[model samples]
Target: MYAIVRTGGKQYQVATGDTLRVEKLKGEVGETVELSDVLLVADGENIRVGVPAVEGAKVVAKIVEQGKAKKVLVFKKKKRKGYRVMRGHRQMFTALSIQEIM
Candidate 1:
Protein backbone atom coordinates (compact mmCIF):
# COMPACT_ATOMS: atom_id res chain seq x y z
CA MET A 1 0.00 0.00 0.00
CA TYR A 2 1.01 3.59 -0.54
CA ALA A 3 -0.01 6.86 1.04
CA ILE A 4 0.23 10.54 0.28
CA VAL A 5 1.11 12.58 3.37
CA ARG A 6 1.81 16.20 4.08
CA THR A 7 4.61 17.50 6.25
CA GLY A 8 6.34 20.82 6.58
CA GLY A 9 4.11 22.31 3.94
CA LYS A 10 5.06 19.69 1.38
CA GLN A 11 3.44 16.51 0.11
CA TYR A 12 5.12 13.14 -0.34
CA GLN A 13 4.09 9.73 -1.59
CA VAL A 14 5.45 6.95 0.59
CA ALA A 15 5.17 3.21 0.94
CA THR A 16 6.35 0.76 3.53
CA GLY A 17 10.16 0.54 3.84
CA ASP A 18 10.65 3.64 1.68
CA THR A 19 13.07 6.28 2.86
CA LEU A 20 12.83 9.92 1.89
CA ARG A 21 14.21 13.25 3.02
CA VAL A 22 11.76 15.93 4.00
CA GLU A 23 11.87 19.36 5.66
CA LYS A 24 13.45 19.11 9.10
CA LEU A 25 11.27 17.69 11.85
CA LYS A 26 11.66 17.38 15.57
CA GLY A 27 13.03 14.21 17.22
CA GLU A 28 16.23 12.17 17.03
CA VAL A 29 17.23 9.14 15.05
CA GLY A 30 15.19 5.98 15.68
CA GLU A 31 12.26 7.97 16.93
CA THR A 32 8.90 7.14 15.47
CA VAL A 33 6.87 10.00 14.04
CA GLU A 34 3.26 9.81 12.99
CA LEU A 35 2.14 11.84 10.01
CA SER A 36 -1.53 12.53 10.47
CA ASP A 37 -2.12 14.61 7.40
CA VAL A 38 -2.77 11.79 5.02
CA LEU A 39 -4.22 13.04 1.78
CA LEU A 40 -4.82 9.72 0.12
CA VAL A 41 -4.23 6.01 0.50
CA ALA A 42 -4.13 3.30 -2.15
CA ASP A 43 -4.01 -0.46 -1.99
CA GLY A 44 -4.00 -2.38 -5.23
CA GLU A 45 -7.31 -1.41 -6.85
CA ASN A 46 -8.70 0.25 -3.74
CA ILE A 47 -8.27 3.99 -3.23
CA ARG A 48 -9.33 6.42 -0.52
CA VAL A 49 -9.02 10.18 -1.03
CA GLY A 50 -9.72 12.89 1.49
CA VAL A 51 -11.44 16.19 0.94
CA PRO A 52 -8.59 17.78 2.85
CA ALA A 53 -7.21 14.87 4.76
CA VAL A 54 -8.40 11.39 5.53
CA GLU A 55 -9.87 11.19 9.00
CA GLY A 56 -7.97 8.90 11.40
CA ALA A 57 -5.56 7.94 8.64
CA LYS A 58 -1.86 8.24 9.43
CA VAL A 59 1.56 7.17 8.25
CA VAL A 60 4.09 5.87 10.72
CA ALA A 61 7.75 6.60 10.02
CA LYS A 62 11.03 6.25 11.81
CA ILE A 63 13.58 9.01 11.83
CA VAL A 64 16.71 7.60 10.25
CA GLU A 65 18.82 10.75 10.02
CA GLN A 66 18.88 14.47 10.55
CA GLY A 67 20.96 16.46 8.08
CA LYS A 68 21.29 19.39 5.75
CA ALA A 69 21.10 19.60 1.99
CA LYS A 70 23.83 20.87 -0.34
CA LYS A 71 24.65 24.52 -0.01
CA VAL A 72 22.98 26.93 -2.43
CA LEU A 73 24.97 30.01 -3.37
CA VAL A 74 23.41 33.37 -4.12
CA PHE A 75 25.50 36.01 -5.84
CA LYS A 76 24.74 39.51 -6.92
CA LYS A 77 26.88 41.97 -8.88
CA LYS A 78 26.46 45.50 -10.15
CA LYS A 79 28.41 46.87 -13.10
CA ARG A 80 30.87 49.78 -13.05
CA LYS A 81 29.68 50.68 -9.53
CA GLY A 82 31.82 47.82 -8.22
CA TYR A 83 29.21 46.29 -5.92
CA ARG A 84 29.05 42.61 -5.22
CA VAL A 85 27.37 40.32 -2.72
CA MET A 86 27.40 36.62 -2.11
CA ARG A 87 25.68 34.23 0.27
CA GLY A 88 25.34 30.56 0.86
CA HIS A 89 22.68 28.45 2.56
CA ARG A 90 22.05 24.85 3.47
CA GLN A 91 18.50 23.64 4.07
CA MET A 92 17.95 21.29 6.97
CA PHE A 93 16.16 18.01 6.38
CA THR A 94 14.98 14.89 8.08
CA ALA A 95 15.28 11.41 6.62
CA LEU A 96 12.33 9.16 7.32
CA SER A 97 11.70 5.47 6.79
CA ILE A 98 8.07 4.67 6.22
CA GLN A 99 7.05 1.84 8.48
CA GLU A 100 3.31 1.55 7.93
CA ILE A 101 0.12 3.25 6.85
CA MET A 102 -3.02 3.07 8.98
Candidate 2:
Protein backbone atom coordinates (compact mmCIF):
# COMPACT_ATOMS: atom_id res chain seq x y z
CA MET A 1 0.00 0.00 0.00
CA TYR A 2 0.98 3.59 -0.59
CA ALA A 3 -0.15 6.89 0.81
CA ILE A 4 0.12 10.55 -0.05
CA VAL A 5 0.82 12.64 3.01
CA ARG A 6 1.47 16.30 3.64
CA THR A 7 4.19 17.63 5.91
CA GLY A 8 6.18 20.81 6.16
CA GLY A 9 3.92 22.36 3.53
CA LYS A 10 4.80 19.68 0.98
CA GLN A 11 3.22 16.43 -0.11
CA TYR A 12 5.00 13.12 -0.52
CA GLN A 13 4.06 9.70 -1.77
CA VAL A 14 5.32 7.06 0.61
CA ALA A 15 5.13 3.32 1.05
CA THR A 16 6.32 1.02 3.75
CA GLY A 17 10.12 0.96 4.17
CA ASP A 18 10.59 3.92 1.84
CA THR A 19 12.83 6.73 2.99
CA LEU A 20 12.62 10.38 2.00
CA ARG A 21 13.85 13.76 3.10
CA VAL A 22 11.45 16.58 3.93
CA GLU A 23 11.48 19.96 5.65
CA LYS A 24 13.00 19.60 9.11
CA LEU A 25 10.64 18.11 11.66
CA LYS A 26 10.89 18.19 15.41
CA GLY A 27 12.32 15.04 17.01
CA GLU A 28 15.53 13.08 17.20
CA VAL A 29 16.65 10.03 15.34
CA GLY A 30 14.59 6.91 15.98
CA GLU A 31 11.57 8.91 17.06
CA THR A 32 8.30 7.96 15.48
CA VAL A 33 6.28 10.69 13.85
CA GLU A 34 2.74 10.40 12.63
CA LEU A 35 1.72 12.30 9.53
CA SER A 36 -1.99 12.94 9.86
CA ASP A 37 -2.53 14.91 6.68
CA VAL A 38 -3.06 12.01 4.41
CA LEU A 39 -4.38 13.11 1.03
CA LEU A 40 -4.84 9.71 -0.53
CA VAL A 41 -4.29 6.04 0.05
CA ALA A 42 -4.02 3.21 -2.41
CA ASP A 43 -4.05 -0.48 -1.82
CA GLY A 44 -3.61 -2.40 -5.04
CA GLU A 45 -6.74 -1.57 -7.08
CA ASN A 46 -8.50 0.14 -4.21
CA ILE A 47 -8.07 3.86 -3.83
CA ARG A 48 -9.26 6.34 -1.22
CA VAL A 49 -9.00 10.06 -1.69
CA GLY A 50 -9.70 12.78 0.80
CA VAL A 51 -11.60 16.02 0.69
CA PRO A 52 -8.57 18.07 1.69
CA ALA A 53 -7.46 15.18 3.87
CA VAL A 54 -8.62 11.71 4.69
CA GLU A 55 -10.22 11.56 8.10
CA GLY A 56 -8.36 9.34 10.60
CA ALA A 57 -5.81 8.33 7.96
CA LYS A 58 -2.19 8.63 8.92
CA VAL A 59 1.30 7.58 7.96
CA VAL A 60 3.76 6.26 10.50
CA ALA A 61 7.39 7.15 10.00
CA LYS A 62 10.63 6.99 11.94
CA ILE A 63 13.06 9.85 11.98
CA VAL A 64 16.27 8.51 10.54
CA GLU A 65 18.22 11.69 10.19
CA GLN A 66 18.03 15.42 10.67
CA GLY A 67 20.38 17.42 8.49
CA LYS A 68 20.86 20.27 6.08
CA ALA A 69 20.72 20.18 2.32
CA LYS A 70 23.45 21.33 -0.02
CA LYS A 71 24.34 24.98 0.12
CA VAL A 72 22.80 27.29 -2.49
CA LEU A 73 24.79 30.31 -3.47
CA VAL A 74 23.22 33.61 -4.42
CA PHE A 75 25.28 36.25 -6.18
CA LYS A 76 24.37 39.71 -7.37
CA LYS A 77 26.31 42.40 -9.16
CA LYS A 78 25.69 45.73 -10.82
CA LYS A 79 27.55 46.50 -14.03
CA ARG A 80 30.13 49.28 -13.83
CA LYS A 81 29.04 49.99 -10.25
CA GLY A 82 31.55 47.64 -8.57
CA TYR A 83 28.66 46.53 -6.34
CA ARG A 84 28.51 42.83 -5.63
CA VAL A 85 26.90 40.57 -3.09
CA MET A 86 27.17 36.89 -2.36
CA ARG A 87 25.26 34.65 -0.03
CA GLY A 88 24.92 30.98 0.71
CA HIS A 89 22.20 28.97 2.37
CA ARG A 90 21.57 25.41 3.42
CA GLN A 91 18.02 24.21 3.93
CA MET A 92 17.34 22.00 6.91
CA PHE A 93 15.64 18.68 6.33
CA THR A 94 14.46 15.57 8.07
CA ALA A 95 14.90 12.09 6.71
CA LEU A 96 12.00 9.76 7.38
CA SER A 97 11.55 6.05 6.98
CA ILE A 98 7.95 5.13 6.28
CA GLN A 99 6.87 2.38 8.62
CA GLU A 100 3.20 1.99 7.86
CA ILE A 101 0.01 3.60 6.56
CA MET A 102 -3.24 3.45 8.45
Candidate 3:
Protein backbone atom coordinates (compact mmCIF):
# COMPACT_ATOMS: atom_id res chain seq x y z
CA MET A 1 0.00 0.00 0.00
CA TYR A 2 1.00 3.60 -0.61
CA ALA A 3 -0.09 6.90 0.81
CA ILE A 4 0.20 10.65 0.40
CA VAL A 5 1.01 12.48 3.58
CA ARG A 6 1.66 16.05 4.63
CA THR A 7 4.38 17.12 7.00
CA GLY A 8 6.34 20.26 7.64
CA GLY A 9 4.11 22.22 5.31
CA LYS A 10 4.74 19.87 2.43
CA GLN A 11 3.17 16.81 0.84
CA TYR A 12 4.89 13.57 -0.14
CA GLN A 13 4.03 10.33 -1.84
CA VAL A 14 5.38 7.41 0.16
CA ALA A 15 5.17 3.69 0.66
CA THR A 16 6.65 1.13 2.96
CA GLY A 17 10.47 0.97 2.94
CA ASP A 18 10.74 4.23 0.98
CA THR A 19 13.37 6.65 2.14
CA LEU A 20 13.01 10.35 1.43
CA ARG A 21 14.48 13.67 2.39
CA VAL A 22 12.15 16.29 3.74
CA GLU A 23 12.46 19.71 5.35
CA LYS A 24 14.53 19.32 8.48
CA LEU A 25 12.63 17.60 11.26
CA LYS A 26 13.58 18.15 14.89
CA GLY A 27 14.68 14.68 15.86
CA GLU A 28 17.69 12.47 16.17
CA VAL A 29 18.64 9.41 14.21
CA GLY A 30 16.54 6.33 14.89
CA GLU A 31 13.67 8.37 16.22
CA THR A 32 10.19 7.27 15.32
CA VAL A 33 7.72 9.78 13.97
CA GLU A 34 4.09 9.56 13.05
CA LEU A 35 2.57 11.54 10.22
CA SER A 36 -1.11 12.04 10.92
CA ASP A 37 -1.93 14.24 7.96
CA VAL A 38 -2.59 11.47 5.55
CA LEU A 39 -4.55 12.86 2.61
CA LEU A 40 -4.89 9.79 0.49
CA VAL A 41 -4.25 6.08 0.52
CA ALA A 42 -4.28 3.34 -2.07
CA ASP A 43 -4.33 -0.36 -1.56
CA GLY A 44 -4.47 -2.34 -4.77
CA GLU A 45 -7.81 -1.48 -6.42
CA ASN A 46 -9.21 0.58 -3.58
CA ILE A 47 -8.50 4.27 -3.19
CA ARG A 48 -9.43 6.34 -0.15
CA VAL A 49 -9.38 10.13 -0.02
CA GLY A 50 -9.84 12.18 3.10
CA VAL A 51 -11.89 15.32 3.26
CA PRO A 52 -9.19 16.77 5.45
CA ALA A 53 -7.65 13.62 6.80
CA VAL A 54 -8.88 10.12 7.20
CA GLU A 55 -9.90 9.14 10.68
CA GLY A 56 -7.24 6.92 12.29
CA ALA A 57 -5.02 7.10 9.21
CA LYS A 58 -1.35 7.54 10.00
CA VAL A 59 2.06 7.04 8.44
CA VAL A 60 4.90 5.81 10.57
CA ALA A 61 8.53 6.62 9.82
CA LYS A 62 11.99 6.33 11.22
CA ILE A 63 14.54 9.10 11.14
CA VAL A 64 17.64 7.79 9.44
CA GLU A 65 19.85 10.79 9.98
CA GLN A 66 20.16 14.53 10.17
CA GLY A 67 22.40 16.20 7.66
CA LYS A 68 22.92 19.15 5.36
CA ALA A 69 23.01 18.95 1.61
CA LYS A 70 25.81 20.05 -0.68
CA LYS A 71 26.47 23.74 -0.70
CA VAL A 72 24.80 25.85 -3.36
CA LEU A 73 26.78 28.88 -4.47
CA VAL A 74 25.08 32.14 -5.24
CA PHE A 75 27.08 34.85 -6.98
CA LYS A 76 26.32 38.35 -8.09
CA LYS A 77 28.54 40.63 -10.17
CA LYS A 78 28.28 44.12 -11.61
CA LYS A 79 30.09 45.07 -14.78
CA ARG A 80 30.84 48.76 -14.61
CA LYS A 81 31.64 49.71 -11.03
CA GLY A 82 33.31 46.40 -10.11
CA TYR A 83 30.92 45.01 -7.51
CA ARG A 84 30.94 41.32 -6.65
CA VAL A 85 29.10 39.21 -4.13
CA MET A 86 29.16 35.52 -3.37
CA ARG A 87 27.16 33.34 -1.02
CA GLY A 88 26.94 29.68 -0.27
CA HIS A 89 24.14 27.73 1.35
CA ARG A 90 23.72 24.17 2.54
CA GLN A 91 20.12 23.27 3.20
CA MET A 92 19.33 21.15 6.21
CA PHE A 93 17.23 18.05 5.64
CA THR A 94 16.00 15.03 7.50
CA ALA A 95 16.08 11.56 6.05
CA LEU A 96 13.13 9.36 6.83
CA SER A 97 12.27 5.77 6.09
CA ILE A 98 8.57 5.04 5.63
CA GLN A 99 8.01 2.03 7.82
CA GLU A 100 4.26 1.53 7.70
CA ILE A 101 0.90 3.06 6.94
CA MET A 102 -2.15 2.48 9.08
Task: List the global CA lDDT of all models.
Answer: 0.97, 0.96, 0.94
User: What C-alpha lDDT, on a 0 to 100 scale, does residue 66 get in candidate 2?
Assistant: 95
lDDT of 2 by residue, 1-102 (tens): 999999989899999999999999999999999999999999999999999999989999999999999999999999999999999999999999999999
Q: Which stretches of candidate 2 lie over 4 Å from their true place?
A: none
TM-scores of all models?
0.95, 0.96, 0.91
| Candidate 3: tens digits of C-alpha lDDT, residues 5-65 | 9987999999999999998988899999998999999999999999998778999999998
Single out the weakest 10-residue window by summed lDDT for candidate 1: 6-15
The runs of at least 3 residues in candidate 3 whose Cα sits more than 4 Å from the true structure, single-residue gaps closed, are none
* Per-prediction backbone clash count: 0, 0, 0
lDDT score for candidate 3 against the true structure: 0.94
Task: List the lowest-lDDT window of 10 residues for candidate 2.
Answer: 4-13
Predict model 2's lDDT versus the native. Answer: 0.96
